[model samples]
Target: MATNYNDYFKKNNDNDNNSNNTGGGFTPPELPNFLNKPIVWIIAILIVLAIFAKPFVVINQGEVGILSTTGKFDPEPLNAGMHFYIPIFQKVYVVDTKIHIINYKRIAEAGSMNDTRGGIKLYPSINVLDSRGLPVTIELTFGYRLNPKTAAQTIATYGFNWEDKIINPLVRDVVRNIVGRFPAEDLPIKRNQIATLINSKMQEKLDKLQSNPVILESVQLRQIILPNKIKDQILSVQVAKQQAQRVQYEVLKAKQEAQKRAALAQGMAEAKKIQAQGTAQAITIQANAQAKANKLISESLTPKLLQLKQIEVQGKFNEALKVNKNAQIFLTPGGVVPNLWINAKDKQKASVSK
Candidate 1:
């Protein structure tokens, strides 16, 4: 039975092999021909091409590219837009060419008398000799710009640490030199003049140092720390000056008001005088007119005119006596008979006599 089983297995295996030899057996699918090639070679070629094309870099507006070959800086700069470089041999660094602000605090701990020292550790406190040779601390800020043309040189000479070596030291030196010339009191009050001096000196020194890459825009005094004993004295002086100016202004205002009142009074007096004069002139004119009328009347009264007037008066009296029942006559000087009547009969007789 074992021999028969082995014979049967062998017969089946042979049959399977025979079928595979023919077209009756199944076969597995093959991979694409291109995938059969070495993938490392293709990857190496792509990397090489990418390295050669490494020069394609876009530089935006207001930016400059610093190119270096083998760690040596190129003299010429790469301007904005697309620029190309060798990948392995050359390097490009982008720098913003626009204005930038760097805020440096000169006094960090404010409002404390003990921490009055300026915040910056780069420079020692400025020593300005007063008349008494006292030390004063001054805080200030400076604005600067990086010159694009000299940026490469600055990096080469100062190794990109120019702010510490060139800028801060020069600023400290310039400030000290300028502040030393002025007294402690002048540092706080006359800061404008001090700033002007500092700016001028800083510009001169920077030009000398050939660090023209950094430009000083403006210098401003942030604070002045004085000894506690003298602070009140300085404040008092300033207050006195202000008070004096206020007093002067008040005096000037009062003087102007007094002058205005005096002028008004004078105007009123002048007007009243003119009115009184006019009244006096009018009275004199009226008196003269009255006197003239009296003179004319007296001049017209001659002796004959007087006699005619007397006769006229006597005739009027006689007529008046005729109308009255009682009347009388009185005799005066120069045969002048003034008529009077006692009764109607007497008045009729008197009229007949006239």
Candidate 2:
């Protein structure tokens, strides 16, 4: 910290002198005359200051920086990093490149804005005229991102509010145009078709842009708000359809039950017919067997056999007359018929001998 400038300079001078005389020791090179000038030093100091305390912008991830020289924006965008620019003549605009959402819903359905970021925006549900000129409300959500490659050009052409001028207008116009092609009542039923048309049309329009400024991610149709009368009519139609289906099902069930009962009755009738046929057959068979047995008995009978039977009957009568002394005995003409005797004691009773 002590003063040593004089001795230090003198020692360097002596070494230079010795080098000049002996040509043995190394000599320090002299500074250029221009570098020693005050203006040159000032310029150097200013350059250093510019490097250390420069005007700068940070291009974060999911962001791109657009450099502007004077008023014209550079076509090529700077990637994520610290970017320096001249204070007055140059500037860099940091634009987000991440996916962003635009929600079109009823005003009553919009949530608190405090939770939203620069990337998320909310608008009132789109109102469009149907083919019948009836007003219909369309609620939807779509995602998009700034094309980093063309972000600068997009910002230059559409300004920083490009989403409003480009996306919002495009979406609303597409919805109105497409929705206007159908009746209000049809919108709910054709919601998927409407949504598909909207997304494709928007993408087509975006692709038609010079730089393809926005990349559309996806589009979702959240709700189709129809008039109360249309809703009531749809509900009534659905209810009527349900009632008709119920009636048809009941009719089918009744037909099945009737068919089952008819099948059962037919089965019972066939069973009774079979039973009657069996009984008739059994009676005929029995009568035939009994007639055959009687025929055999009649074929075996002879005249002598008849006489023998008559004599036996007479012998029995004689035995009976011995028991009842006054009994009256009578013989039939042939023994094929048995003889009869009347008891004298009981006039009403008679005895028969076989």
lDDT of all predictions, in order shown? Answer: 0.70, 0.84
Cα-based RMSD of candidate 2: 9.5
Give the poorly placed runs of model 1, Cα more than 4 Å off: 1-44, 47-55, 104-132, 242-268, 295-312, 323-354
Candidate 2 residue-wise lDDT, 248-267, digit = tens: 99999999999999999999
lDDT of 1: 0.70
Worst 10 residues of 1 by lDDT: 113-122
Query: Model 2: runs farther than 4 Å from truth?
Result: 1-48, 84-87, 108-118, 260-354
Residue-wise C-alpha lDDT for candidate 1, range 65-93, written one tens digit per residue: 88989999886778888988888899888
Per-residue lDDT of 16 in model 2: 95
> How far off is residue 75 in model 2, in Å?
1.2
Question: Over all chains combined, what TM-score does candidate 1 have?
Answer: 0.67
